[model samples]
Target: MSDKAKIAVDAMGGDHAPQMVIEGLAAARVLYPGVRFVIFGDENVLRPMLASFPELDAASDLVHTDEVVTSDCKPSQALRRSRQSSMGLALQAVKDGEADVAVSAGNTGALMALAKFILRTMPGIERPALVAPVPTLRGESVMLDLGANVECDTRNLVEFAVMGAAYARTVLGLSRPTVALLNVGVEELKGKETLREAADILKQASHIPMEFVGFTEGDAIGAGAVDVVVADGFTGNIALKTAEGTARFMGELLRRAFGSSLLAKIGYLFARRGLRQLREHLDPNNHNGGVFLGLNGLVVKSHGGASAEGFKTAVITAIDMVEADLIRLISADLPDVPGHEEEAGAA
Candidate 1:
C-alpha cells in the first residue's frame, strides 16, 4: 500500500460510467501523477475499460462487485439493501483505511446516506453539509448546504459557517475567511426569523476563526461578497441551480448573437480569447465536486452527468482536500462554538 493519497472511485456511479470514470481517472493521472486509485465495480465491465488507459491501469487497483445503486434509488433503500454496491463499497474503502477519500457520481441521496452511515459524523456536527466552490467576479467562494439539509436550525447554520470557513482557508488559501448568510436583503430586519436568528448568533460569536459579514443578497453570491455563503439546503439548492441555468443561458445567448451576422462573426473572432476565458471560468465541470463536510473521511460527489473532464476535476478536488487535512481542521475549529460540547456529546 502506498503512503500517498489513494482515492476510492465508484466506477459504475456516473451516467456515462464506467467509461467516463476510467477516462476521467486517466486524465487525472496526468495531473496527479503520484496519486493512486482503487476502482470498485464489476470486473468484467471495468477491466475492459481499464485496459484502454494504460496509465490508469498502472496506477489503479480494481475491486470487483456486481451491485450498483441506481440513480433513482432512495437513500433508505440503498442503506438497507445496497451496502455492497459500488457507491457503498467506495465509501467502505474510506472507512477501512484502504483509501484516503471516496468519489462518486452516483445518486446524491444514496451517496450522502451511505457516506454518513459508513463514515459517521464528526464530533460536533449534527449533519454533513454539501459544499462546493462557486465562481464569482472577485473569485471563487465556498457555499454550503447545497442540497443536504432542506431545513436548518441556528446551530446548523453556525456549524456550516465554521466548516465553510475552514474549507475556504484550505482551498482558497485565505487566512481568515469572511462568511455570510444568504438573505432576501442585506439588512438586519429584511429576512425570515431563521436567517435573522442565525445572523444574530454569528454576529455575537467570538474566536470562531472567521469574519461574519452580516448578510448577503442573492445577487452578491457571484459578486464574491464573502468567502463562504451559508444557507439551508432548500434555498441553497435553488440558488445553485439558478446560477447554473443563468450561466448556460448567457452562454447560449452569446453563441446565438455571435452567429447572427457576418459582422457578429467577425466580432466573435476578435473576442474569442476573452470568451474562452469566461467559459473556462464559468464551466461547471471545473467545479464538479460537492464535498460532504462533517463525515469522518472525505467523500466528494461528482455531478451525475459530468463528463470525463468533469470527473477528473472531482478527483483533483479530493486530492486537494486530503492534502489540506480538511477533517482535522474542522475538528480543531469545532471546539470554539458555545454549545458544541453538549451537541457533540449528544451525537
Candidate 2:
C-alpha cells in the first residue's frame, strides 16, 4: 500500500446511495487530503455527482456497477451475485490488494458473509467479529462481536478479546487497553462456562497487549469500566441496541421535559450549552464505523441510514486502520494465545 490510503467504497449500499457516498468522499478528502477513493456504483449516477466535487473527483476512481446488494437480501443470496454487486466489488478491491480497506453502509449480514468468504479469517481466527466504538463516561471504549456470531465458544470469546484489544490500541490509541468480558455479573463464578474459561485464558495470557479486568456487567459498559468489552454476539448486540435506544429515549425525555411548562422552557435556555455538548457526545454519527475484525483485510460497516457526515466518519475510520496497520497488530497478537497454536495446527 502507498502512503496515501485507498478506500474502496460501496457507493450504492446505503439508504442515501451514491449521493451520500459522494458527498462523504468529498468531505473526507478535505479532512484527509492524502486519502484516495475507489468507488463502485452506477456510473450514470456517480459520475454526475462526482463532478460536483472537483477535488474528490480528482482523488477518486469510479467503477461502474449498477448491481447492488439489497438490505433484505440474504447472505446466501448475496454471495451468489457477489462479483457483480457494488458491495461485493468494494470488498473484492481490498482482497485483491487494490485498496487498503473497504467501507459500506450496506446489508450487515451480506457484508459479513462476503467479507469472510472473500478475505477469509486470519490464520488462528475462526470467525470475524463486528467491533465498534461506544461512547462511555470515560470518553470512549470499544466493544466486539456486536452481532456477528450469535453464540460463541470459549476460544471464540478469547479471540474477540485479543482482536478487540488490538482494535482499541490501534484506533483508540490505547497502548495497553483494559479488557473485560460482558456478563450477568462481575464475579468469576457468574455467566456461562465459556465466559469463565475465556477469562481464565486472558488472565494467563500476559503476552497479549491488554490488561484483563475479569468481568463487567452490562450496566457498567457506559460507565467506562473497561476499554474493551468482549461478549458473545447475542449479548453484545442486545447491549449495543439497548444503549442506542436509551440515548434516544433520554434525548426525547429531555425535549419533552423542557417543553412541558414555561418555567421548564426558561430553564432550558440556561442549560442549552451543556445540553448541546451532551447531544454531540451522544451522536451516533461521531461513532459510525463498525469494523469486521479478524479478517485478512479491513472492512468497515457504516449505518444504512447514516448521513454524509456519518459516512465520512466511517471513511476516516478505514484510513485510521490502514495507518495503524490494524491487520498486522491483530495477526501478531493472535499466535501467543493459549489454544491458538493448536487451533491453527488443526486447521
Candidate 3:
C-alpha cells in the first residue's frame, strides 16, 4: 500500500450509475486530498464526465469495462461473469494489491458473493459479516450481520463479536468497546442455544479488547446500550429495516403535524431549526457505508439508491478502514480467542 489509500470503485453498479459514482468521488477528493481512486466502468461515459471535475480526474485512474452487474442479478450469475463485470474487477483490484480497499453501490448479494470468491475469508473466519455504524441516542454504535448470512452457528456469532469489536475500536475510536448479543431478552438463558453459547465464550475470553455485557434486547440497539451489537443476518436485517422505517414514519408525521392548521404552522416556525437538525441526524446518507468484515481485504457497500453525498461517505469509510489497518487488527485479535487455533486448523 502507498502513503495514499487507493480505492477501487464499481462505477456502473448503482441505480444512478456512473454519474453518481463520479460526482461522489469528486466530492470525496476535496475532503481527502491524499487518497486516489481506481474507477472501473465504461471509459466512453466516464471520460466525458471526468472532464467536468479536474481535481477528481487528476486524482483518479479510469479502468474501462462495459460489463455491469445489474440490480436484479443473482449471486450465481455474478460469479460466472466476475472477471468482466465492474463490481468484480474492482474487488479484483483489492485482491491483486492494486488498491487498499473497494467500494461499490451495487447489488448486495452479488457484491458479497464476488468478494468472498475473490478476496476469500480471513483465517479462522467461516463467513464474512455485513456491518454498519448506526446513529443512537447515546452516540454511534456498530451492528453486524445485516444480511450476509441468514443463519449462523455459535462459532459464527462468536467470530462476529470479535470482528465487530475490532470495528468499534477503529471506527468509533473506543479503546475497549462494550459488546452484547442481540437477543429476545437480556437474560443469559433467554434466547437460542447458539446465543447462549456465543455469550459464554465471549465472557471467558478476557484477552480480547472488549467488554462482554451479555445479551441485549432489540429495542436497546437504538438506545446504544453497547458499542457493538452481534446477531445473525435474519434478525439483524429485520431490526435495521424496522429502525429505518420508524425514522421515516416519524419525519412524515412531523411534517403533517406542522402543516395541519394556522396555529400549527406558527408553531413550526419556532421548531424549524431543531427539526432541521433532527432531519440531518436521521438522514440515511449520513450513515451509508456497510462494511463486509472478515474478508482478506477491505470492501464497503454503499446503498444502491444512495445519492452523491451518500456514496462519498462510503468512499471515505473505505479510506478510514485502510488507514486504521482494520484487516490487520482483526487478524491479530482472532488468534487470541480460546479455541480459534483449532478452528483455523480445521478450516
Candidate 4:
C-alpha cells in the first residue's frame, strides 16, 4: 500500500477489456498495495476477477460498478448520453474527489472528449496536451501534444514548451532541461511562420526554467540533446507512430532472420540476452502511455491495443504520477506562461 492513490480504471475500455485489464490491475495491486481501485464495469463480471487473485488479501481495494463504455462510442456523445458508462462514472469519481487519478485504454477520442468535459482545463490552460515519455539515447524524453490539439498558434506552442519542461523536470529529474520546437529544419527559418514567431517569443521568455534549444529534427529526437519536443498533435502523433512502427518492423525482420535456421537460432541463443535487453529498451508499450498535460490532475492514457504487461506499466506510471504529485508541481513550476509573462504582468 502506497497511500491510497485511488485510481478509477476502465475494466471494459480497451480492445482486450475486462480480461487483460483485470490481469494488469491484479499485477499492479501486488506491487503497489496502497492503490485501491474503483473498477468501472459490471459487478458480476468484475467481482470474479478481484476474487480470483488470492494474493489480494484486502477487500477494501476495489469498487465495482455495472456500467461499461466501449471503444466504438464517440467520446463526447458517450460522456453526454452514457452517464452510467464506466468511462463517465470513473471520471465522475475523480470529479467528485473519490479518486486521485483516472486510467483508460479505451476509445482515445472519447477519453479526451470526456476528460476535457468532466475534469475541465486548469486556470490558464486553454486546451490540454497529450504528453508521452519517450526513451532517448541518454534515458527518456517528453513529446508533447501527442493527439490533443492539432492546429496551434505561437502561444499554444509556447505553452506546450512550458508544460513539457515542467514534466521533464518533475518526472525525469532533469534540471533546466532543454526545450525544442519540432521542425523540418534545425534553423529558425525552417518551419512555418508560427515556428519563427514562437522562436522569437521563447527566445526572451524567463518563466520556463528550460534552456530554449530552438528547433529539432526527427533524427535529433533520439540524440538526447533536448528534453522537451514541442509540436501540434498532428505532427507529434505522426512522429510517435512513426517511431513505434519502425521499431516493430525492425523487430519482425530480426526475428525472421534469427529464427530461420538452427545455427542462427544458436547464434541468437548466445545473443539472446542482448537482444532481449534491446527489445525491452525499445518496447513501445514500456513507456508508450502518456499524461494529459495542462489538466489540474494527472490523467494517463495507454494504447487501445496495449497488452497486459503494457497496461500494468501504465498503472505503474499512473502510480508514479500520483506519488510525485506531478500536477501540483506542474502548476507550481510556472508563475506564468512563457512569452506571455511580461504582457500579463504589465496588465
Model 4 error, position 49 (Å):
0.9
TM-score of each: 0.96, 0.97, 0.97, 0.92
How close to the true structure is residue 304 of candidate 4, measured as C-alpha lDDT?
A: 88
List where candidate 3 sits over 4 angstroms from the true fold.
1-3, 343-347
**Candidate whose lDDT is highest:** 3
* lDDT per residue as tens, model 1, 29-58: 887788899999999988888888888898
- Residue pairs clashing in model 1 are none
Give all candidates' CA lDDT scores: 0.91, 0.92, 0.93, 0.80
Query: Stretches of candidate 4 above 4 Å error?
Result: 55-66, 338-347
Q: lDDT (0-100) at residue 28 of candidate 3?
A: 88
How well is each residue in 1-347 modelled by candidate 4, as lDDT tens digits?
A: 34568888877788888788888877888788767877788777777776777654252345556666666787667767766778777777888988888888888878888888888876656688999888778888899988888798887888788888878886688789899999999986798999888888888775557899889999988767689999999999999888888888989999999989999999998999999988998887788568888776667897888888889988888887788787776666545555444544443
Which residue pairs overlap in candidate 4's backbone? 1-33, 1-34, 2-34, 41-65, 75-110
Arranged by lDDT with the best first, the candidates are 3, 2, 1, 4
RMSD of each: 1.7, 1.4, 1.4, 2.4
lDDT of 4: 0.80
Q: In model 1, which regions exceed 4 Å deviation?
A: 1-3, 342-347
Model 2: per-residue lDDT, tens digit, 90-133?
99999999999999999999999999999999889988999999
- Single out the weakest 10-residue window by summed lDDT for candidate 4: 338-347
Candidate 3 C-alpha lDDT tens digits along 68-112: 999999999999976678899999999999999999999999999
